[model samples]
Target: MTVVDVPGSKSLTARALFLAAAADGVSTLRRPLASEDTEGFAAGLTALGYRVERTPERWSVQGSPAGPPHDTAEVYCRDGATTARFLPTLTAAGHGTYRFDASAQMRRRPVAPLTRALRALGVDVRHEESEGHHPLTVTADGVRGGELALDAGESSQYLTALLLLGPLTRDGLRITVTRLVSAPYVGITIAMMRAFGVTVSRENTSRGEVFSVPPGGYRAADYAIEPDASTASYFFAAAALTGHETTVPGLGRGALQGDLRFVDVLERMGARVRVDDDRTTVSGTGTLRGITVGMRDVSDTMPTLAAIAPYASGPVRIEDVGNTRVKECDRLAACAENLRALGVSVTTGEDWIEVSPGTPRPARIATRADHRIAMSFAVASLRTPGITFDDPGCVRKTFPAFHEVFARTRAAWGLAAAASPDR
Candidate 1:
């Protein structure tokens, strides 16, 4: 069995950065993912006047529970959606005039839900160019948080932003969420909040699911980040495509990211899976079965499964992932278009895509500069020769050396690949 060490979780790293920066004292994060998105998050904190120190192996943030030290700042959140959505809310708890903007890709993604909730909570948030889009300003007078309601159907970041802001509020916050997607991400936020010494009580109510957060601020603590399960999906997909055995360390039974459950999807696709205390392994049995799955919670992996779907014996239909349309790009359409480019039979709806069994032909994939698109299609290239990506380096957003790592892994398994330039 070949063992692969995936980078730290982007979701965990982003949340940890927010928690560490908002805690009461110095906070240290071990083995944080060093990438465009995460570095952008740390930079956003620095722009807000928070002290953050970075090293090759760890990151240290000096927390300021009272909010940002800067009275005014302008933060450009690179292609990271979490940085765009979360940092503005972080500034809301501080007394400052903060202007936030992002890349064209991020600006296209919706932030109206989160911005709407912040406006309702009495923060002066304004969209400079387009309503609910970035190039926005937040004139924070400090949040005197109380009861509020939210709709998080498009993205869970809105709910997580509110949950993160709860401790910094004067009266705490009681949030009732009307609709939520990617519910597992909120679980990650709550668990991290507890690690920072805050408790968020959640329950089902008639109106909706309610989260009651106390007014006391967070306490700093040393935290270790787990390996990214979403990144590991590409590696796991590689093994499944080539009938190899691959093991990824640092993600096991107690892993927090919802994307880790991707192994279950693999298991359903006729792959052998083993989850242990410190690692998870996927072994191909040389038979990939098609599946119809609802990927509402694990939509990030939809591209991963879609990239490998043509290898299945039957049909692969992915459903309940409408939120994916607003991600870095319209993932469903991207997958369908790329697969069709490979001469594969594929059909798509607003929320679903169905791929029929066929041999994927040689074609160049259009990455659209989305990291997941680049990485997921890389897996498809393991089986189809001459498959290349338009923008392979876009993987720098999460895994900067994705092409190198994938090439080495392919060589180790004695499998030939032609995805990224490095291959």
Candidate 2:
């Protein structure tokens, strides 16, 4: 058995940074994920005149009482969708002129839904170059929040962004989600809002899901982020691929991140899973069974499941994750292409992927600069020899030390050569 202490949640870390900077007083976050995405978020906040102090163990964000002091600020979000989508709404909550832009990869992803919603909510937003994309300018006079509706089908960050700033609106905010995807992430946003001393009342109405956030400000408090369940999926997949028991500390039944639900998918694949308050354990049965599942809520783990699918007894089908297409890369196409390269028969549609049992051949995987791609395929390498990656360093976006940690865990299980750099 091997126990791994995965890093903190990126989702929580981003949300916490936004909330902490907007709250009434100074807030402290313990064990936040320090990565390219999160660092980009912090830098954007600092540019907006929010004081963010970082230490090895924690982060202290001094709140902006009257919103970001800067009247004009240029925010650069490098390859972080959450930072790109969330920062605009956050900046719009205050009175400022802000320009938001991202890296070349992030520019391709859509931000129209969130920006459209912000414009409807009475923020003076202009898309500098594209209609519904990045390189936008926000001449903010603060949102005059009323009953507003928008589609969040492309990204849940749209809903989260609006909801995070809902309380600060002029007359409170009643947001109706016209089209929703990744519903579980909305739950995460609400839970974190409540943690910061704000309550978001959600109801299922005939119009859609209505989120009624009263005009009450957040009270700053110390918060601790949980271990990232998305990162844990890779290690858990290691056990299934190698038939070994793996335990990840600090995340279990009560994990806040929806990616923890990936364990249920693993359990359905015939792995023994045990969850406790503090830790979760996965014991492989030396066999895996293919099953069909809709992964819209936990789409981050789709690649992990696809990587392990070749070892299954039958075909594995993943559905309802089309939102993944607009991520760092076309994840659906990336998975299909990479699986085929590994000699796994795969088929994909708009939002579905089907993987059949096959002998995965040794191949160099093209990660396409996606962290999930690099990490998920690493699990497959444990069972197949000579499985290497072309963009292994891409994991620095989330898990900067993914290869080193994976090597340590692989060595602990007597699979020293599995993750060897010289392979």
- Taking every candidate in turn, the Cα RMSD to the unseen true structure, in Å, is 1.0, 1.2
lDDT tens string, model 2, 81-176? 889988888888788789999999999999887777787887888888878888998888877789889798888889899889888787888989
lDDT of 1 at 357: 97
Clashing pairs in 1: none
Candidate 2 regions off by >4 Å?
Answer: 419-423
Candidate 1: tens digits of C-alpha lDDT, residues 288-344: 999999999989999999999999999999999999999999988899889999999
Most TM-score-accurate candidate: 1
- Model 2 earns a TM-score of 0.98
TM-score of candidate 1 against the unseen true structure: 0.99
TM-score of each: 0.99, 0.98
Q: Cα lDDT of model 1 overall?
A: 0.93
Model 2 lDDT at residue 341:
97
Give the C-alpha miss distance for residue 20 in model 1, angstroms.
0.9
